[model samples]
Target chain A: MKQKIRIGSGAGFSGDRIEPALILAEKGELDYLVLECLAERTIALAQKEKLANPELGYDPLLEKRLIGLLPLLARKKIRLITNMGAANPIAAAKKVREMLVKAGLNLKIATVTGDDVLEKLDLNELSLEGNKAIKNYPEIISANAYLGHEGILEALQNEAQIIITGRVADPSLFLAPMIHEFGWDTQNFDLLGKGTVIGHLMECAGQITGGYFADPLKKPVPGMETLGHPFADIFPDGKAIISKVNGTGGVVNLQTVKEQLLYEVINPFQYLTPDVAADFTTVKLHDLQNDRVEIRDGTGNKRPETLKVSIGYLAYFKGEGEISYAGTGAFERAKLAEEIIVKRIGNQFSEFRTDLLGINSLHKSTFGQDTIPYEIRLRVAGKARSIEDAKLIGEEVEALYTNGPAAGGGVIKRASEIIGIVSVLMNRKKINTQVTYL
Target chain B: MKLLEIAHSRAGDKGNISTLSLIPYEEKNYQLLCEKVSIEKVAAHLKNIANGKIERFELPHISSLLFVCHDALETGVTTSLALDSHGKTLSSALLEMEI
Candidate 1:
């Protein structure tokens, strides 16, 4: 007899409070909880941490989330998988061990990270040691081979109540537990695809359930402050019922699910991943009514030929500083402030670039930013191969508010550290993913 | 040669990062991607177009890139991404990057 597994998705995995996600997992009688954190810039941050200290660069959020979660989950006996170990799972796991023990929750945790070491692999041709097609570059700030779902499953089988990973594929966290609980074979492409899609839909947590939906979600059910992280209830047949933590602030509805489905999907007919690219278009979703959507008919196809690697490099110099103006004509004055700063900074620095980011521009998001607001918040950020050059930028930017037309009208914020930017020279290399339980 | 459109994205606090994938007409044409792309160069080029710092990230996959493309944000994309040797509309340039 196969075990039944349920799936849920929501956001807010990290923050001061995250109990709602855990509370839902407990209520739903779910066997697994998967969290997705870590993206491109995160990879860069992880790389920075790795360079600073290989022992600890993973997402700090997971640890905090686990403290609130581990005890409750240990009570439920639900297993978990997360890629929150942004750069170094081994280090993060060390912290997790302490948390579990401190929480008085006895549990085994598996921390997976060898992929972060790709930075040390010598790929003269840009081929990531694990991916054979990407071009290798002379320098990389961070590099990690996307791990497959099997790793997560292995951890679960080893009685690892909690699994902390550096950077497992986003969908793999949800699917791995499905593969484990249902005893689904890796060769079962159809079932694998079903699980993968479920994971994909839920990977963003609340994103699927109205977090980023084009439509609106239902009002206050439970756990609003929790921001609604997700959990899954999986059936042996590979069908999942997605939901969020109860009492959360956000709502999960049909539109939310649809929006997440369309995310990052290149070809609905050929959704690609090293594990298996399933045709999501073939899948069907039914409202099924009453806070549940039944996912069915997900067809699995051939796996994409390539695996992805996050290539990051130390920025030679990076800095962030902002200038703000208020009152009438303040916006124009703010605009001039940017030009004057850039012009003055340019006088002393060559190969320097400046950005005039407006708080309004940021608030509008992916659309027109200047439609409203007479006051503007400007941020001047740039990078250079030299730290010395970067410092000059901060000085010139400050000069604008003190000596320029907007003199003293602008408030300067603390500056950001100048860091070098790394680019990926495509490198594809082959990695032996075969792992044995330790 | 078959043309396939690809979409790539990354996620973070601001939200999920995405880009309209313009599949190269064929795989062999991928060589040109390297010719036209370099980290420092992409950063500089994006700055020229958006006049803002472009936060770029490398995506892992058989052959996919997940970029934030902070400034390239525009409406329902109207312009096709590929261009020709002389800077004409790209008719084809990627079978698969590696066939």
Candidate 2:
């Protein structure tokens, strides 16, 4: 058994900086460089792209990121794992194969599919938020179940250098590599949970580091401009140490790790994933020297019987317009503009919102009315059935330029289609995972 | 003193629920955080924007408190018409609350 293996995070999201990943590939001695680029709605967007062109369902930055890391990966013999395939893994794998061949690098690549369960799923069987039926929305663009580590482990076991997947769990991308290397059993819930905690911490790339840990003078992190990405050193026992690259500008302490541990998590005792039900409440973190923090004692119960499926549907057309007002009575003028808009195009839009940007936009009704601001931007947005109907909301707001509000400047208007998401639970037995190598 | 004086926070959204983790710089402040930052106080503080039930989880090992505010994002990120769809700035907004 290996004593320890290092896995570095390349990119956190789809559009994350690629240069930091190259730095890891070149300098950081890593067994695997995992890039978690898929977000909840990203695959849905990719599905739309796939509809336009069958060969373009993967992440837009896939080519750019590979162009930067392929050479270093080949040199270092570092394996690459990513969920950047989005809605299409085969096309992404093909693209990577073409890139590698062009560079004359004989690297093995694998793609995992079967997460796209749209066709197999019955809308009647699915429910969203207590009794809400999926059948109500007929415009579903994409439906994908969150796959576990089985497919990823299968790919690794086949000696694939690069593993690309679609709609796998974020932590699974990191955990699969650990499971394959350590020869860990799939049914070992405790080890799986422990490994998952490591994956979760390192999944956000720089969150465990200091990218999202800065607060100017309050909690200052050095080298904010070129923040370092995070990596984990996993031991045979499943305990791991989370740290960043040497000479990189980011802190890995209890505070940063703790903040990230609870990020996007609901119940501390039950962080549900396909592999394990991880209990992070008892997890401990010790700050070691050189920006390393040892994380231990992550326990788990049996895995959930069902998997969560993210379903994206065409919601409606959104029309938005923003116009700024300045000087003494700016708030009043913005309010007047909102009232005028409601009077003009209120019935046209199915649902709409008007906000005074500088005033009570974010924390609405939280702060009591006080002193009037020098400037206020009136933003009115609405959703309609059609693009032409949605455009009217923006048009009505633009009419305020000549129709009402005094000194309305910087008028910006836009109309676009909105994607709506619904979550449903699917039985684990229903979904099947497939792995293919190229 | 304000919450920002002693603690730092990060907020993230999953569907309509938004979770904010408040981690104190000093371990001693964990007790103070538990005392001052209650579910009621948090719900009251964000009463305007967050209209759902508030649940708090204590992670004493890490000296942090997590607040999960349901129905907080106006709606989900993809569906919400709000300016800050992900509610990323809610952590800073919550930090502004005086203790």
Task: State the lDDT of candidate 2 residue by residue for A1-438, as single tens digits.
Answer: 788999999899998988889888888899999999999999999999999999999999999999979988999999999998999999999999999999989899999999999987788865564356788875989999999999989999999999999999999999998999899888999999999999999889988888888777977889877888988889989999888888888788888898899999999899999999999998998989788899999888899999999999898899999999999888888888888888888777778898888777787753444677788898999988999988987788888888877899989999999888888999989999999999
* Fraction of native contacts (fnat) of each candidate: 0.01, 0.83
Docking quality tier of candidate 1?
incorrect
Q: Which is the leading candidate under DockQ? A: 2
**Per-residue lDDT over A1-438 for candidate 1, one digit per residue giving the tens place of the 0 to 100 score:** 456765544233433235555666667566666666666557667667777887767886766667777776788887767777777777777788888778777788787655654645454434322234333332356666676776677777778877877766777877777777778888888888887888777776766554443222212234334466556567888877766555555655544555466555545556655578776756666666645677776868666555665555443454445666777876677778778876666555333444334432321232222353656666665545566666666666666755866543444533333222222232224544332222
Worst 10 residues of 2 chain A by lDDT: A363-372
Q: What is the TM-score of chain A in candidate 2?
A: 0.97
How do the predictions measure up, each by TM-score?
0.72, 0.97
In model 1 chain A, where is the ten-residue run with the lowest total lDDT? A360-369
TM-score of 1: 0.72
Count clashes in each candidate, considering only residues at least 3 apart in sequence or on different chains: 72, 0
Give the C-alpha lDDT of model 2: 0.89
> Chain B, candidate 2: TM?
0.98
